[model samples]
Target: MRKFIVAFFMLAVLVSLVSCEQKESQVVDRKAEMKTSIDSLESVLKAAEGDLDEDLGLQMIDAYVGYAKEFEADTASVIYWYKAGEIAQNIPGKELYAVTYFANIFEDHPNHALAPQSVFLSGVAFDKMGDKERAAVSFEHFLEAYPSHDWAPDAQAMLQMSTDTTDLDTQVKAWLENANKTQE
Candidate 1:
């Protein structure tokens, strides 16, 4: 009876170990699946490089943003989020998504080379969306963070324009022209 009881306990222990291993395997499978999805999305983005149809680009951006949100700590997440923000800013009715994605980049990877650009673009996205208050805030944040960046003058102009009450399109055009001049 003692030997039988010991055998039963040993079997239970083995089963528990097997179950734990299976759970670990399941986690690994999930991570692999996520990586595959991210890679596939990146490939799609790459394939669309020259064509860049707005609808398809928006779809890709949405997919990338979804994956970025799911894998926030991954390097791919930062790249995907930045790409999504760039695409979002150009698409009509998607400026807020651009703002969100750019803000995410700035918040998650503040030391990255793209962080200042993200902040500036977030302001542009807000301005494009007609949210002057938020646009001003984002522009101010960018200037405070990168006072001497090449984009600083543009950010300052945007901050001033945000409170100008002028036609947004006209202001944006003037700012772009001024920015181009500065770059020249």
Candidate 2:
């Protein structure tokens, strides 16, 4: 009876070990599946960059919008948004879209190293949209918040330009002309 009892105990221990291992394997499989999904999404976004289809590009951009929150505290995503802002601003009627990207980096990731640049780009996008008052406000906020930042000088210059002229319409016209020259 003693020998039989010892065998039973040993069998129980072996079964428990197997069960633990199976659970570990299941967890690893889940992790791999999640990684695969993220990678697939990234690949689709990258490929969409060169796609001539606006619908596909916009779809990818919308998909990336979901990942924007995931990018919180991630400096790389800040840079990515900054670049996306640059691209979106260049496309006519997309300035507001670009504003959203820049605002994400500036507001959600304020302490990020790229936050100042992100704010500056936000102002630039606003300016491109002919919203001088809002642009001035954005630039002014960046200057006051990050006075020592590398982009501070540019922001300050933009702020001065934004305020120097009394006529809003004239400033708007000049800004558009300058923007056209850059686009060309």
**What's each prediction's clash count?**
0, 0
RMSD of 1: 4.8
Q: Mind giving the per-residue lDDT tens digits that candidate 2 earns over 1-184? A: 9999999999999999999999989866754654455466557657777443455445445545544455344444566576567667767788998888888887787888778887888888888888888889999999888998888889988888776855879878889999999999
**Candidate 1 on 20-53: residue-level lDDT in tens?**
9999898678667866765776677688675667
- TM-score, one value per model: 0.69, 0.57
Look at candidate 1 and tell me the lDDT of residue 183.
Answer: 100
| Stretches of model 2 off by over 4 angstroms after superposition | 1-60, 69-77, 166-184
Clashes by residue pair, model 2: none
> If candidate 2 were superposed on the true structure by all CA atoms, what would the RMSD be?
7.3
